[model samples]
Target: MLNFVEYTTQSALRNAGMRSVISFGIALLFFAATLVSFQVTDASAQSACFERTALMKHLSGKFEEAPVAAGLAANGSVLEVFSSPDGVTWTIVLTQPNGATCVMASGESWMGMKKPKKDKVS
Candidate 1:
């Protein structure tokens, strides 16, 4: 009788362990599927124009100072520009609001211009 009781208890524990492992495996599969689906959706949702290399290339050259503008990002980073007095060379700078500054791009033949004066109001 003691042997039979012990065998039944051992079998029950083994079944419970197997069930737990299967449940864990299924949970992992579900999580992996969710991640893959999110990646697919995110890749399709992005715009081509926002490609990093294309954007960097497009923004690489000189810009007319009067029309080109800079602003603060939502995350408190700053986009700005600096040019030599002769305006033959330019440097684009990105300054984080935290006081860190970096050069984004630089090039020769940059042109600086004075802002156009508005006509006097009648």
Candidate 2:
């Protein structure tokens, strides 16, 4: 009968709608779990070297990849030269993956007296 056919079609549509909602919810949950996992792993990470060029420029020198402690994973390139005020003192800035910057000074470089933090106008 026409009534029976109509009922069956409506039931099918309702089931399809429920399935879509369930699928969407499951997908959202999966995405959330993935983001949480990435955050956890990234927080404890030590290397973040994607902006190598910018970091090198900020250090004011060139860097060549070199070995480091903590096995091969911990090793990175060292910055050979970084220019600061005073001809003598060259600050070597080392970039680490864990978003840590380390500075080392060459003994030949003299720090001289404290200069005001202001820049010299051209």
C-alpha displacement of 104 in model 2, angstroms?
Answer: 22
Query: What TM-score against the true fold does each predicted structure earn?
Result: 0.38, 0.37
RMSD of each: 12.8, 12.8
Query: What is the per-residue lDDT of model 1 for residues 1-122, given as tens digits with 9 covering 90 to 100?
Result: 56998999999999999999999999999999999999999987753333333334544543433215578889998776765556666767676766656656767887666888898979
On the 0 to 100 scale, the lDDT of residue 101 in model 1 is: 61
Candidate 2 Cα outliers beyond 4 Å, as residue runs: 47-122
Cα lDDT tens digits, model 2, 1-122, are 56988999999999999999999999999999999999999875644343555655654544332222222233763444454444443544556656555543334443445648788778
What do the candidate models score in CA lDDT, each in turn?
A: 0.68, 0.57
Candidate 1, residue 6: lDDT: 98
